[model samples]
Structure formats: structure tokens, C-alpha cells
Target: MMFSATFTSLCLAAVAVALPAEKRAAPTVTDILNYALTLEHLENAFYAEGINNFTQQSFIDAGLPGFAAGRFSEIAQHEATHVQFLTGALGEDATQACDYNFPVTDAKSFAQVSYLLENVGTSAYSGAAQYLSGGTLTAAAAILAVEARHSAWVNSAVLKANPWNGAFDTPLDLNQIYTLATSIITSCPSSNPALPVKAFPALTFGTDMTAGQATTVSFNGSDASSANGMYVGFISGMNTTIVPVQNGQVTIPDGLMGVVYAVATSSDSMTSDNVTLAGPAFLSFDFKSDALLL
Candidate 1:
């Protein structure tokens, strides 16, 4: 009779669990870094190819500024240096190298060449600045500035206007990079033409919390600006089923008492999440803060 009641309760609980809207998992920091590195490699290769294929004489004879050759060389070398620094930092064994994807093969047509290289380069650097750290941050800033210059030069040559559409200029920072990276991963994962970013990576954690502490796992989310849509839940197949403490949130069940637990969340479209849930029935984890991407 007791077993029958318990089985019925479990069935009801399963039905309840299936009722809410699910969240797509969030990507881990490691995932962000990997994508950033891959993009840097692609940009490096593109610049290298551009340098080899474009000569100063071609632009000068085409009635463009004589300095265009030097600018191209400078940007190419800068991109190469960035690739070297990132690869060294990530280590050869850890980093995955990728091939170049240039949109155009010919540079003889100045407007087309300018549009292809400068704007694309600017977008890549600006988009990636946030995911970088330490020396990588400095490198990204330097590259971004140069890319901006390249964009300005090209825009003036092509559209007869300032490259920045606005009269104002905005500084790109790590947070902006995070924003752009999340945006790119969400919207145009395949549009890079050079680097293909997979779904944003997810993170898992081994957490430590005081008894009764509350925590929240968060990410940029699929929408990027808000944290509303993620499907967050705790592992409940074991003896103690965690209860929902709030919307799309769960907590260490009161019955868990002094035990530690393993918790996980799987996004339908993104990376999976897993973490250690340690507690005094007071333990908690903030998924966004605690997780590191694999």
C-alpha cells in the first residue's frame, strides 16, 4: 500500500515537471574563449592571404592612395601577431586551428576589396573583444583600433562618408565583447564565413554553499539581454527531489538535510549544464557565476 502511494506521487511529480516552458542551456566561458580563438585564427589567415595577394602597386595604379598598401600590410601584421599571442596563451595542444575564409579573392577592385576586408575585420574584432582576457584584452583593443582605422579608410574611399555611421564613437570593452559574442552565437553562427561558431558553450560547477544560502545560475541567455527564458531545474531522480523555489528555479530540498547532490540542466539548443550541489539544506549555486565552460 505504501509503495503504491509513493509510485502515484512520483507519477504526479513527473507530470508537474513537464508543464513549464523549458530553457535552452547557456554556454560556458571556455566555449566563448574557444570560439573567440577560432575567429582570431580565421582573421589571421584572411589577412595573411590578403597580404600575399595584394600589392602596393596595384592600389596606387588604380588611382587610390599610395598608403593603402602600407595600411594593408600593417593590419595584416597586427592580425598575425594577435593569432600568435592567442595560440601561445591557449597552448598548442588546447587550441584548434582553422582555415581562412575571405569573401573575395581579388583586390584589384578597390571598393569591393575595401568593403570586404575592412568592415569584416572591424566586425570580427569588435565582436570578439569581450571574450578575451589578460594580454588577449590588450591585443584585442589594439586590433580593434586598427580595424576601426581600416574601416574609416575604406568607408571614405567607398561611400564618401565616415565609417562610424554616427558622428559619435563608442569604445568596445570586454562586456561589449560578451554582448556581441552572445549575439553572434545566437543570431549568425554561420555568417562569419571564416569561423563557424557552434551553439554557445555551457558551464557546470562544483559548488560550496553555507546552510540556507540561496543561489541563481544565469547566463546571457538565448535572448542575450534578459535571463527570462532559461529552463532551470535540479536533479530529482534520487531520494530527495528538489523543489522549485521560484520561477524556473530550484533549490536544495529541505529533506536533503546535510547531504550533497549533483544537479544538471540541459538546454534544448545550447550546451549542457552540470554541477555539484553541496549543502546544509542551505547550499546554493549561481549557475552563471560558478560554471566554467569545458
Candidate 2:
């Protein structure tokens, strides 16, 4: 009788241990807002570098803005002010200095730089707003508007478009911005990737666009031959065909939104999980294949 009782207790304890721990609720607006500030700082640094380069050019250059030097300084100052504003509401804990190292290896043109900053700033602010409330939302909106201004000016400067009314006049949604921002953050050397293998934490996945909404999707691989094994599509829509362009580029026939899927496997592999993409918002995936194998 004693032995049987002990066994029953042991089994009960084991079952308790095996059960999964309950997950905590997602973070609030305050948390998301504060976190997004860190990313802003990263952007500020990138623009500062570009602006510095712009001002240093001897005489006048085609792409350099009229207020290149002054504008960079002003933008940096605004970013600083934005940081100060956020820190006041959030405290010292809010504006944590990141170990930033943007991933874009090479950036030649002014337009490319502007596209990176405007698209990202717009997206980060939008995605972060979902988490905020009352005053924070208003503050976020204010910052978002300024970011839009930065994006606008940068776009005009780079593309030689009219500053007041550029081609991309409308603001990008959080989801769209998140995709662009995270890509730049991860690929650019100026932005930091917390985990070498991890995507940006502030990322928001693309939405599932309904019919009539034209969306363009593209992909580039590390190597030319690798393109053959790649597949890209949305979660529910017809898995559109991906056309190979040149060595690394692959274009998909789908609009921007929903959970996009990309799978790449080489000749030496024959498995679904070989190369997979996963993240908080499914922004970009990490690969696990023979080549990736250590």
C-alpha cells in the first residue's frame, strides 16, 4: 500500500512538471513605444553619417541637398529631442543605447539612403502605435509625422523629385514599414542585429491584401544557382510563380501583405525544414541547411 501511494505521487509530480508553463500576455503600448525609440536612435545615426558625407563634398554635388550639413545636424538634433521627449515620459530605462551596427554593406546613392530611412521610420512608428495609449499614441503620431517629413525630404533630395510633392507622398503603414525597416536594419552594417541570426524585434509582418490591391514582391539569394530551389508566396492566396531574373533576383506575383513564405533547398538536401524563415512577425527567415551546418 505504501509503495503504490509513493508511485502515484511521483506520477502526479512528473505530470505537473511536463505541463507547459502559461505564456504571459503580449506587451503593452508603453512597452512597444519605448522599444521603438531604440530603433529610432539607430536610424538617427545612419542619417547623421549620410548627412556628414553630404556636407563634406567639395563645392556642390548633384545629389547633396542645399542644407545637407545643416539638415543632418538639425535632423540629429530632432532625433535627440525625440529621444529626450520619450525618455521624459519613460524614464532612463526607456532610452537604452543600443549596440547598433546597420547591415547594409554598401550604399552609393542618395535615393537609396532616403528610401531606407523614410520607409523604415514610417513603419517603426506605425507598428509601435499599436502598443501605446492616450498620450503615448499622440506623441507617437507626432514623431511619426516628423519621420514622414524626414522621409519626404530625403526622397526628394535623392530622386530629384519636388520636395513638397514627391512620388511616394502617402505614408506607409506599420506592416509595410516594418518589412522595409527590418530588412535594412538587418542588412545594413550601421544597424545592429541583436542576435546575428535574429531579425529586428520591432518588425511587423506584411498584411494579407485583398483582391484589387496590387502588391509587388521580390527576392534575392546569396548565390545564382540557389535561385532554382527558392519559392515565395502568401499563406492563403494562390502560390504565384517566382521568376528568376539574372543571378540573385526573383520576383513574385503578389501584393504586399499576409504571412509570406520562402523555402530554399539545395541539391544535397531533401527536407522541408532545410531553409526556413521565422520571426515575431515573420519578417525574414533564417536558414538551416548543409551549408549553414557547422
Candidate 3:
């Protein structure tokens, strides 16, 4: 009965809608802004925690040059500004900041979590970017650019390569974005700006490829018996479903070659994924794009 499927999809495009056309009211710009505001709050809180916990020396000790270290503080300031700006735009209707439970408890983990969050922000903004207009577009566009820069800087630190990774980037749609992100957010008191509440599995990797000879990947994060429990999400915009990774091994799409990615709770999470459900954490590595096209 699903008809009139629109394309708001990202990293994996073309989502299907089963609702009758008459029941689907188009999302207003405010709705989109509210969603974005929630994500900004998440970024702001993440950086605040990092800034509170780390010092410039922390960056130096982590092998980053002292000159580039200030970027972290700068980024924190920017995220805070974004939070303020969005809240101001929403006035009394703005979403309240909720306490977060990031995976980082140290500088090393800070770097890792920051790398993932920024990319999440990037895709979040990118996917929602098309919905804005006029003033909303102006404010968000600026933040989007900076978010990209933040990701590039961290990407370079993580990979020790050029700050820019590619000419174009893939985005995560609403469902995909929230499914991957809501896992780390421990609590959201306001709930006005709704967020995807799902317990995504924490996926881990074991070198799944060897370039030309090996184009496959493997996962070992959930119960071995949860057949079809693992799903590979790629920045190249593809969500691949793997039933039972034989001994934790399966082939990946070449389209995801040399791109950013995450291992989520499974494609099924898109609909059934609820934040309250207990499941493995989502895995988005901080190192070079995990399982890249060697």
C-alpha cells in the first residue's frame, strides 16, 4: 500500500512511505529547524564536556601540533554559539539542553568521539539543509560550513592526511541520522525537539579487506545468534543488510570504498529502533575511515 515515495534519503537514499498521500503533510521549515536545533544542542554539550576535560597540552600529548590544538577550543566556542543562536531563534519554544553520555572519558576518547560527532553533525546538517529557506538557510549554511571544517580538521588528525577528504560528502537522512546519533545521548529532558530514541548496537571491526584481493568486511559486536543483526552504513549513501556474517565475515559494497561510515543496530532499526530498547552501541571509529578501499 506504500506509494508516493519521496527522496529525503541520505548515505542511503530513496526512503519509502506507506501512508496515503493525503495523510502526509509536508514538513514545515520550523519542524526542520527544530530538528536541527536538537542536533546542535548535542554538539554543543559534547564540546563543552571536552573543553572542560581537556587542555591544550592534552592535544599536544595526543600528537597534534600545539598551533592546531587551539582549534578544539575554537570549535567548542562555535558550537556553543550555534546553541545560543538556535535557542534565540526559537525563543520560548526552543528545545532545552539535555544531559548527554558521550563515550569519552579521556583525551584519547575525546578525539575519537569528536571525530564521530562532527561527522554526524555534518551529515545531519547536510540532510536537513535542503529544507531551509531565507533566514533559516542563512544561519544553518554558516554552521554547516564550519561543521565540515571541524570534521576535516579532526579527520586529518585521525588520518594524518589532507584536511579535505573528498570533493563531495554523503549525508545521513532523518531516520538514518537519528538512529546513529541517539544512541549516545543518555537523556533528553525537553523532548520537544524530538530525537531518534534507539539503542543501536556498538559494532566493532576486524580488518575485513586487503585491497584488491579482499573487498569484504566483518563484524563482531552483537550476539552471534542474532542473524541479520548487523548492518553496514556507509557515507557513500548505502545501507547494506547482512543476514549471518559467517564467522563474522561478509562482503561490503564497493560504493562505500574509502568513505566514512558506521556500524548500526541493523536496517530494521529504522522502524523498530527505539531509544528505550536495550541493544549494542553503534560503532563509528575515530581512525582512518574504517575498512577503507585499501
Candidate 4:
């Protein structure tokens, strides 16, 4: 965990693996602030778009109880507050909002989109917790808590019976979070920001599961030649396995049939069984995913 220090030199040495070797100086608090700012900007835009494009009648048409404009608007305001706070904190180093293209085309999909954003937002804050200094850490923890609440509220409203999905929540690394973020993000002002973003894997699955066919699952990416094996877990993380990359693709001879909950690289091993004394981890925002493969 980062110690309380001046914003000028917030260190990221804790997660050096997440950073590139080209940088000489350690990652500063500005980096974390800028990244959080970018995410807030994106989320703000997402809600704003839905708010302006959809109406109360639209919500009713979608089979939802009431117009979610007020709820979503409040959430958007929270995100805006985060953006403003981060921008003010960064002073000259703040990142400008980038052009983004979210996937939701209709009001009915707002809750679905919120599920992805809020959960990812919560994970992003948790994963980055180690890099935050004491004061910034407290602020980040506050935001993380609200983001989780937003996620829970959305899930309860949308999914109904099972609002919270899993007993073991997954904490993703920087690359994973930013990769998902940039999937919908368009042009940016620079090649790299405080939080680095890489070109998407251009990942595509060969197995046609849309037809309910449970054939072998194989995936290919633009940079698959250099990539390691792919790891997959079900939404509950009850079942997970590894598929090796060969000849520019990762293939599972017998792919399981289910909705995938999480996917990561070989470096991050997620499936494990841990029934431990949960003491210090209560104070830690970053928690390991130790779901058993059942």
C-alpha cells in the first residue's frame, strides 16, 4: 500500500510489472489521478448519452418499473464529481476527455451497460489501490465503495433474483482493465497516459456458440504469436481452465459451454481454493480471486 505523500511523487513501484520499461521516473500520483479521471469521464459520457437519448416512456417501454433517468443522473453526477476532483488534483497533468463509442443503442440496454461499467470501475479501483498514497488511497477507497454500490444497485434492478453474482470477486490488473476500457474508446490525445493502454488483441473466437454448438473453443489475436496461454473462468468461477496458444491462436480441444466470467493471461492464476481467516484482507481493497473449480 502507498504511504501518504505529496501528489508530486506518488509511486507505482509496487506494480512495476504493470508499467513499461521505457519510463525512467517512477509513476506518480498524477498517473493514478489521470487514469481515474479518464474512467470517470467515460462513465459520465455513458450516462449522459443515455439520459439525453432515453425518456421515462422509454424506460416503461423497456419493461422496467420507472424512469431511471433520476437514478442514472445521480450516478453521472458522482462520476462528474470524480472527474472534477481528479482534474483539480492533477493540475497540469490531467488527461482530457477522449471520444468514446459505447455499445448500448437503446434505453433497454442501459442497465446491462451499467453492469459492465460499474463492476469494471470497481475492479479498476481495487487493482490500483496498491499504488495510491495514504490520502489518495482514502479518496480512491471512497470512490471504489460508491462504484460497487452503483454496481449492486444496477444488478438488483436488472438481474433481480441474483443481484450480487459471486462470492469471490476478481481483481484485475491495469492492462486488463484498460484493455476493456479502450475497447469502446476512440481516438485519444496521446499514445500513452498516466495509465497505459495497449492495442486490443483483436481477439476473435472461432467456436460458434451462438448456435448452441459446443464445439472446441479457439481464439486468435493479432499478436497471438507472442502471447501466452489464455485462461478462462465461468461467471461463478466454479469452472476454469487454460488453453495454450499455438500457431498464432489459443485453442481448447473441448471447450466448456457457459457464460465466461473472467479471462486473463498465464501470469495471473485465478482458480484456487482458500477457506482462510479473513482478517487483514478486510482492510485491503485488493482481494485475490480464489474461487474453486467445481
Candidate 5:
């Protein structure tokens, strides 16, 4: 969905301000703040567009609970508050909002997108926490708790899916999350400071995917015929399972619940981003019964 130019300009004005004459070197913490602010901006705009297009009655008509719309409004407010907090924390160095294209045609679609976004947001915070310290870490922890709650509520109450994934939640690094985020984001202002990260090439599924079945996958810039020693890394919850790729296919392990991120990697270990070849492809599995929810 697209917002009006006037609305976009106003939103940008509210958050973006001028830095000092002498450009101060940004520390790791500052970069993290800006990265967070960029995500907050996207989320803030997403909710605004969704809530504006779909009403409370519309949600009920779409088979969601009566209170789902109001809860979404509250979530939107939380995202806005996050934008404000991050912008304030970064002062003049905060990143500006970007133009986006969320594919939400109706209330049900909106709820599904919200569930995914909240889970990704929670994971982003969890992954970045290791790099923070003192009051900054404490502040991020507070926000992380709220993001997790948002994910659970929307997953269970709105989408009617499994709320919790496992004993621990998954953590994704800057490049991984940025790759996912850029799928919806169209563009950002040229004046916005560059983030210290890069997005991987797109990864796609070639055939039907199931929890315990072998599936064909493709990378945008790599040849499957030459993928002799590569591996497919399935990151679910706190576990990272790496299986060797054979003829461009990998067998997904059983008992994997909720959202899982699959990446083509050069090595079995997921400890470094350099090993990531292409992916972090979005996959969802709900193996509640003996069968997978295809």
C-alpha cells in the first residue's frame, strides 16, 4: 500500500533533523539505534496504512475477533512510540522513514502480515542485544519483551496460529533482517545516512515445501548444478540445523513449528554472516497433528 506524498513528507519532518557541523563518528550503539529507527519507521507506516484501510467492522467481517482491530491500533501506537524513542535517542543521526509496498488487501491479510512483522521485530531485537551494553541494553530488553507479546497475541488471537514457537526465540543478524525488510520497502531518502549492512541476494522455493519432505530451492545468483559443497541452514527457534544440499534440494527436518528461516551457506556453522550464501527465505510450519499444515 502507498501513502500520500503529503503524509510521507510530514512523517519525515517529524523525525529527521540536522546533525552538527562536524560529523561525529557513530559508535556501534549509534549504528544500532539508527538501524532500529529504520525498522520502526517501516512498521509505523505499515500499521497506519493497514488500520486506515481496514476498519474494526472489516476485521470482524474477515473472521477475526471483535477486539482485533482495536488491538492493532494499540500495536500501531507502540510502533510509533518506538520510532519516537529511537529518533530521540539518536538525535540528529536517526534514519528517516522509507516508502513501502505492503501487500495487504484485506483484514485477514493484514493480521497475517502483522504476525510475521512482529516476530521478525522481536528477533531483530534479540539478535542485536548482544552488541549493546548498560542502559542501552536495558532499554532494548524492555522493548523486546513488548515485541514478543505483540507477536504472540497476533499469532494466537488474530491469525489463529501457534503463539509460541519453542523454549527460545530465534535471533537474526542485521544482514538477514535487512534482506527481509527490503522486500517490502521500495526506497528511502538519498539524504538518509547509510546503514553498515548489506542485503543478500533473493532466495526462492522451487517446489511445494513440507516439514519432513525434500524440497527444491534456488538462489538468485548461484548455480544449483555447481552447488557441490554448499549447505542449507535451517534456523528455527534457538537451533540451527545444517544439511548438505544435493542437486539443489534439501530435506526439511520434522517437528519444526512456527516460522523458520532457511539460508544457503558455504559452511555448516551459522556463527558468521560471511558464510551466508543467499537466503533467509521465509518458511512457516505448524505440525500440530501427525500431518504438516501445507
Candidate 6:
């Protein structure tokens, strides 16, 4: 997983620019394959760095099972195979790996981030599958299934959180997934193909969040100060619950669980990316078994 000197120099030279929002033609099948390759590169690099930085003993000392590190190694291998598969599918048009900055300080933090990444990857593949057909769709679906398994294992075995969020998983559009991905990505090579996607303005939670609790959210860009009529859409598992934003705050609804992606939208429709004001902010709500008794 060693990056070439050329890739290193490109990362040092400049930060990667966000993809522009200009009107463009529909993405061909090749575009989709390259996009998939781009994500695979990120996931592949993430596991490589994490496993290299933290040993098996580190994971055990951090309270994870002794087998956690080895399991993650297999996940890393899956990502590498995905990178190779997509690269081969795209041939000369494949996207290169980018420089990324994952904020994993220890084995505990590494597991947490891995849980998030795997979930996002699963959702990414699911969302993009609609645009594909025939063999391409079949291949992508296969990868999506594997990604979901990785997510489930990391969530339950490593983090001791619920293995599944709900009966179904949430699907995130390309722009939404790219918005979340940009948080870790630093830069890409200048030669990398410009993806035909644009990220929404960054959004973040200003207060700690819990399910069925009120919390403050913040976002940048022209719409930052205006909360009137904006809705906080929480995409958790199979549900996209929309709650009105009042003065920068919204109360999360009850029963939502696992890695919920919150977005500020102009309307309640979760599928429409055009209405997205800002965000797709990562919010995790561990399954609460005690609440079930109430």
C-alpha cells in the first residue's frame, strides 16, 4: 500500500479541491466504476495505515478481542481486492489513491472509525447500484454485501454495538457519500479524474447527541444563519426521519439506532439531494436495550 513519490509530492503540493457543482451530463458506467475505485482506494489505505500503526496486542490492550486485529486484516484484503477489481474494470480511466487523514489515535479510535467507514461504504454501494445494470449491477451488489458484513462485524464484535441498525440499510447518493468522505481525504493527484459530483456545505453537531434527545447543529455557507423552514433529516437504518429545525436545534426522534447520517434539507424528502442545505453529518446512536422496557 506504499504510495509513490509522485503521489506524495502531489499531496504536499496542494489540498484537493472540492468537486464543482456545474451542470454535467449523466455519469456513464465508466464514471461509476471510477467512483467505486476511488472509494476502494480510500478504504484500502485506511486499513493499511490502521493495521500498520496498531498491533494485535494494542487492540487487546484497548479492550477489543485479540482476534480484532486479524479480522481487520481480512477486511483490508477485501478492500484491496475491490480496488483491484474496479481498477481492472475501468482500465485506463481508473482513479488513483488520494492522501487521507484519519483521526484514529489508538486502537479504540481505529475500531470506531472502521465501523463508520464500513457502514458508509456499504451505503455508498447500495445507493450507486440503482444507476447500474446487468453484470455491473451484479458485481457492485456483491461488493455491497461484503461491505455490509464488514460493517456488521466491526459494529458488534469490535465495538460491541448492535450488529444491525434495522431491517434495512440507508442508501446515500454520490454527493452525500462524497461529503462524508471529504472529512478524511486530504488531497488527490492532479491527474486523478474529476468526479462529476459536488459535496454540500459542511455540517457539524454543536452539542453531544443521543437518540430521542434534543441537540444543536451547525453548518457553514450562505445558509448557516438561517434555520427557518429547514428540516433536520436523520437517515438511520431503513428510516429517514425528518424533524423541523428551530433556531439551530432539533430533537432526534425515538427508536432511531446505529450510525445515523443527519442532513439539513429544505424539505423532508431524504432522497432528493437538490434539497440538501448542508450536511450528512455523522451521528452514532448505539442500540439501547434498556429503553425497550419503557
Report, for every candidate in turn, its global Cα lDDT versus the true structure. 0.39, 0.41, 0.54, 0.53, 0.74, 0.76
lDDT of 3 at 233: 39
Count of residue pairs whose backbone atoms collide, per candidate: 13, 22, 12, 0, 0, 0
TM-score-best of 2 and 6: 6
TM-score of each: 0.43, 0.52, 0.69, 0.68, 0.86, 0.88
Report residue 133 deviation for candidate 6 (angstroms).
1.0
Assess the local accuracy of residue 171 in candidate 2 as a C-alpha lDDT between 0 and 100.
32
Task: Evaluate residue 56 in candidate 2 and report its C-alpha lDDT on the 0 to 100 scale.
Answer: 36
Candidate 3 residue-wise lDDT, 1-294, digit = tens: 000011001112112211111112355676666677777888888888788878878767877655545778888899889888888888876767656667665565576567667767877788777777887888888888998888788757643543543566656556556545555555666346443322233343333332222222322324333445544433343343322233444444333332344443345344233321222222222223452432
Clashes of 6: 0
* Model 3 error, position 45 (Å): 1.4
- TM match of model 1 to true structure: 0.43
The 10 consecutive residues of candidate 5 with the worst lDDT sum are: 1-10
Which clashing pairs does model 5 show? none
Name the candidate that leads on lDDT. 6
Give the local distance difference test score of model 2: 0.41
**TM-score pick, better of 1 and 4:** 4
lDDT for 81 (candidate 3): 91
Model 2 residue runs over 4 Å out of place are 1-25, 51-53, 56-59, 102-111, 162-249, 252-294
User: Which prediction has more favorable TM-score, 1 or 6?
Assistant: 6
Instruction: Kindly indicate the candidate among 4 and 6 with the higher TM-score.
Output: 6
TM-score-best of 2 and 3: 3
Q: What is the lDDT for 21 in model 4?
A: 16
Name model 1 segments beyond 4 Å from true: 1-24, 93-96, 101-105, 108-114, 124-139, 157-161, 167-294
Candidate 6 overall lDDT versus native: 0.76
Model 3 whole-model lDDT (C-alpha atoms): 0.54
